[model samples]
Target: MTEHTESYYAASANEYAPFPALTESIHCDVCVVGGGFTGLSSALHLAEQGYDVVVLESARVGFGASGRNGGQLVNSYSRDIDVIESSYGADAAKMLGSMMFEGGEIIRERISRYRIDCDYREGGLFVALNHRQMSTLEEQKANWERYGNSQLTLLDEEAIGREVASERYVGALLDRSGGHIHPLNLAIGEAQAIKLNGGRIFEQSPVVKIEHGSPAIVKTAHGQVTARYVLIAGNAYLGDKLEPKLAKRSMPCGTQIVATAPLPADVAKKLIPANYCVEDCNYLLDYYRLTADNRLLYGGGVVYGARDPDDVERLIVPKMLKTFPQLEGVKVDYRWTGNFLLTMSRMPQFGRLENNIYYMQGYSGHGVTCTHLAGRLIAEALRGDAERFDAFARLPHYPFPGGRNLRIPFTAMGAAYYSLRDRLGV
Candidate 1:
């Protein structure tokens, strides 16, 4: 068994193929940096197209946020729909919404076709913790309908209670298409698929620098890869040295989660009778759902200027108790924190830094399904199709106003404002 941080998923990761470290210069059709979901997915898609591909990971596969997320495979871009509409207008918003709807389907298809055992479940709920939130959900439902997404069903407080244990929510918008899965398992499975397709994945092979041109060269500690193109899918874990320009565009926000000891099956049923994933509409939202083993995996709290896991349980456990006081007596078995990137616009940043070098990151906690779609689009772009990739490439993204020295302060202030809004219920 591999040594891993104490995450529930880590405790259960399936045994997977071991990838060798890149030890010598190599050549390929594409050199993909970051072996998380996006890189692995791109590698698999590109390899299936018969392109020679090499994936480099700084640590073991899925060691980044890919392995540590809350695992909700949600729909909708990380930004609010209104933001998308106001910025891109109705047509572009409609297009983006349709793309996200299809993104969910892409995840389902991949799971079925690959037979991945990631504990996937459909039926997710977005709850409104108060009347203000309920009204917001109504507006969202109207907007989604305008975009021709009629599958969203509005549920009143009574219905919400039936689906979730918390009386905190006044109503909810149930999108059957949205769901959750074992994210780490999905990442590992995708890497396996890439290998089975004859692509190469080099674990612990961190790309220290890239020489970009027609045939890009990615240099690692022990080896280098020369390829026709490159893809940077490092997301939040793209350490400062690899791509400083990309790193400056987003701030790493630390989020924490805790899973309780398994509740009796009946008790778990009362909490989420339908076994649906639930997230409230708060700026710093509280998301919780039951695991397959009947544990309440609660995720909440944001820590600025911190990466230590020691403070995670203290920050999140209270929020969890507030939602489910019933779990007060239950033992908290697993607690961990993961860093995710948050862009100013909350939209994913995707485009090529150079003509032949492509990069995708800044999903803002909405990467579960979106990353998979991004992988496919990346593969398509590598294979001479750039239409879909161009749509996101054109989405505006601004770097954090202050440079490194002040970026954290700026983000902390922004987070404080959002936290106040969440508290004021505005």
Candidate 2:
């Protein structure tokens, strides 16, 4: 049995320097909770603005979903564009689209400027498994074009086959601007940059309580932080006590991934020749791509409750085989699962609780790019600019009804509905 969590990225984490635990009372211009992408990104931007920032992580840096995601730097919000346009009006939808486009650019620039070694790759294909999916892609393409996104290319089956290895997809949308990167390294690099800019980060120091109001006080087990602003960027893994109201706005869903042993160069090339990340347009999607070392990392399936790493592989490896029968005999070298936050509307939740306590979460599965954008917007809001951030904040969100006691049941009902729809290809 693999001793590690079986996450391919975790097995290959770069040498990250240990951060001191939060053991004493501290003060800062901003105090951030959760050291994943959003928190670290917020810290980096805040520190760059010459603010004294402090970040507190319950576990080690990148210990949550940031380290274990499929690493697809996809654009767009979790909610479908049509839903956004219909619900929030054309003006708000346009702002959301522009923000996502800029998000991709922000990730690219950070990777370049910080020299992060995260196997960053541009170019991604959003494939459609059926004619209905093809129609959806066409609609999506039209939507993007209407919003002035001319870089998106609609690809037929033959064209998609040339771009991807499998002939399973009927069509695809090639987003030249979106791509993938090693997520953990990116998070770590951002933390490093924050520290270099005179910010402090504490790992294994989970915030247990937040005393809301001006100059909020966040208490960890052994320490406390008083700051003019507090940012809750913890997303799914956020414990209940820190911000119970914010936590109730979304449910925690688990996503699983597995990586195959390195394949021969020729074999890997045949599987995914272009090295672009590919995700199908399914309600429960299957996303996979070749690693820098030629291993096939495939991610799919969902669990209502957290399970052991070993169980994660057992459940997902068969899904991988279904996608690539050529990998029938290849052994899965790593397997892991991470929790993701999902809102009732499937849109991210961003806004301040009391004007000074800003929080962002519930990106669903589109966090790689969304979190970076959120960080910048949150920073801008801190600097007294809320125009862009308000666009997302204005999108209404409903708290999960039934509270914590019945949250899982409601989520199960919702998931079952989506699962049935996915099966019926509706």
Candidate 3:
């Protein structure tokens, strides 16, 4: 059995009954593979509608990126609405814009209806380091406003300084709707809700292969699941292993995060007066928030290839200190790395495999809210309402410029170009 990684989330995770592994062949109306946000959300939605559902997880709940991400409830895709409009057409963008904020709404709905204790906080900040970045943020705010996001307020230098206690940012965009949470707890809580709705979840059941057909069969190491409909929610970790076709189209990349030991409440408040999660506007941005226990959780830097670094603190601590030099000499209580699936388009990839099998993945780095949105969309499609879901599916997703053998270096070069532009402030 694969145990959960030793991260702050795992150490401080809520206690729950362990789910059993699949030991006997089982049949159900829907077989959801993966126990993360997408699968859990899909199962919960379907279960609420009285569908027979069975969830198979390779490891414990929230064992992958769903658990290890910097817990920010960001409210957009990796490639924002403007990019969607420019790349696709205005019509396509309009169709997607309607659902842009629905993911965060679904998250809030789940939290309220089920009472998931994930330290739900409200508000997020997009801090700009220079005039160039601030200009881009202004444009971003306008674009978001065009799509009906009226919760945004631009903060000038003095206003942001008062809120963040930092001089690095010239300004910031405060999104009242965007917020942060204890991500792992959200996942586990949703999984528990799934069970309450009459869904069965099997942990430690890695899917070895999936037979695509009208009634597909998902085979695990110890058992098999036969279902009329199959929802493939395994994004970064299971794509290459179980579905090679999807593998050629996406790459997994690693991001590191570090959690400082609990700071004095006064110190924490001084660092972030409003307790809003903050991220820079750089191509390779740094994001930080205060944990429920007052620990400063900071994350940044990405490895093109999804390989855990030997030292997580070495990669993220410097970035944290640069933003908050007041945190110098603070001891880091936990450090870890997690992989998120990235597509060449940097947009999410959603589509159907064969006839009854559906697969959704590739959130780039914005999975917190998007995954929950995907779950609702996938459930809708399965229930014969594919309009909203099909809009995302209609977008095309291609493999990286180079194939799998060279995708890492190719993506790294593209990121480097953007990083240079950010450094030059042009």
TM-score against native, each model:
0.96, 0.96, 0.99
Candidate 1 has a TM-score of: 0.96
The C-alpha lDDT values of all candidates are: 0.84, 0.85, 0.92
Model 1 Cα lDDT, one tens digit per residue, 62-173? 8878898888978878886778989988877766776866667777887888898899988889999878889988998887777666789999999998888876878999
Q: Cα RMSD for candidate 3?
A: 0.8
Deviation (Å) of 31 in candidate 2 = 0.3
Off by over 4 Å in 1: 1-3
Which parts of model 2 are misplaced by more than 4 Å? 1-6, 305-310
Worst lDDT run of 10 residues, candidate 1, spans: 301-310
After superposition, candidate 3 runs with Cα above 4 Å error: none
* Top model number, TM-score: 3
- Which model scores highest in lDDT? 3
Per-prediction RMSD in angstroms? 1.6, 2.2, 0.8
Please give, for residues 120-140, the per-residue lDDT of candidate 3 as tens digits: 999999999999999989999
Stronger candidate by TM-score (2 vs 3): 3
Residue 193's lDDT within candidate 3 is: 98
